[model samples]
Target: MNASPIFHRLALLAPLLCLGFVSISCTGYQLQTGRPQALTHVKKISVPLFENKTLVPRGEILATNSVVDAITNDGTYHIATLHEADAVLEGTMETITYSQVRSTRLDTLRSEEMENTVTLHWQLLDASTRKILSTGKATGSSRFAIDANQQTARQNALPDALQRAATQVVGRLTDDF
Candidate 1:
């Protein structure tokens, strides 16, 4: 009896097909996309009012509220009080600066849009271990149109800056893949 050419080819491909099927079928794992699992052991976190070194008033309060909101929205970690949390996030605003983004057509003599940039530092500490998990300093910026006054511009930028800084701090807290 002679084996056909098609039989020989099919025999070689059969092992490869079986291996593929076996590998695919043997593993029963599905990746969850909603919640990030960068920090394995930590589940709950506390965000107290941040400290601000800048002259900008209420900077600390804004930063604290935004960070807490971001962490809460992440859904990966639960927001808890210091006593109830596994870890605590601490933050400090080092400096805040503002500069002209551009001048407008109507306001030829003055800049109508301004940019506020904040330099900040933060730490993630494990309450149980009494050890720091992460620490870093970064800068965040926001551009806002002036509302005919410097105070209003500063006020508008404060929230924007805080929201961005919160994002930056959360990025520092987690280990990226």
Candidate 2:
């Protein structure tokens, strides 16, 4: 019996597929995101309180602490004081705005969305040389609406906005992508 064209192709592919499986069974390498090579030399980092150019009270402190938390969560970089760091990450908060996103249709107008947004400029530098290795601007926002617990919603959203902004800054600093 003569083999059909489709059968012939399958016969050729079958051996290759078997060979691939055999190779994998014998030895293999798993894909992974290894340590960030760029940050390898950076043993410690100093993130001082960011410069707050806006009127948000304690905005600088919030931004600074959020960045510290992000880096600490990364577990690759050590957080150090400015005097004892390999790199210093300096950030400037350019502006922050809270705006009403929407208003209710009810007789007494109520805010449906309160958006908190922050824009920041950041730089990573060699602590000793003061050479800037990286710098850029990033913005992040978070929103809260009038809910059953208005007080809790307001309290959570503002800090969430700041935290989101700070996380983006950290990602920008370390991410190779």
Error of 2 at 139 (Å): 1.7
Put down candidate 2 lDDT per residue, 36-138, tens digits, no spaces: 4655577789998899898767778887888889889876678999899999999998887778888887833678878878788898899998988777887
Candidate 2 to truth, TM: 0.72
For every model shown, the clashing-pair count is 0, 0
Pairs with backbone N, CA or C atoms under 3 Å apart (clashes), candidate 1: none
Q: After superposition, how far is residue 133 of candidate 2 from its true place, in Å?
A: 0.8
TM-score against truth, every candidate: 0.75, 0.72
Give lDDT: candidate 1, residue 17. 99
Looking at candidate 1, the ten consecutive residues that score lowest on lDDT are: 31-40
Minimum summed lDDT over a 10-residue window in model 2 is located at 31-40
User: After superposing candidate 1, which stretches have Cα over 4 Å from the reference?
Assistant: 1-38, 104-109, 175-177
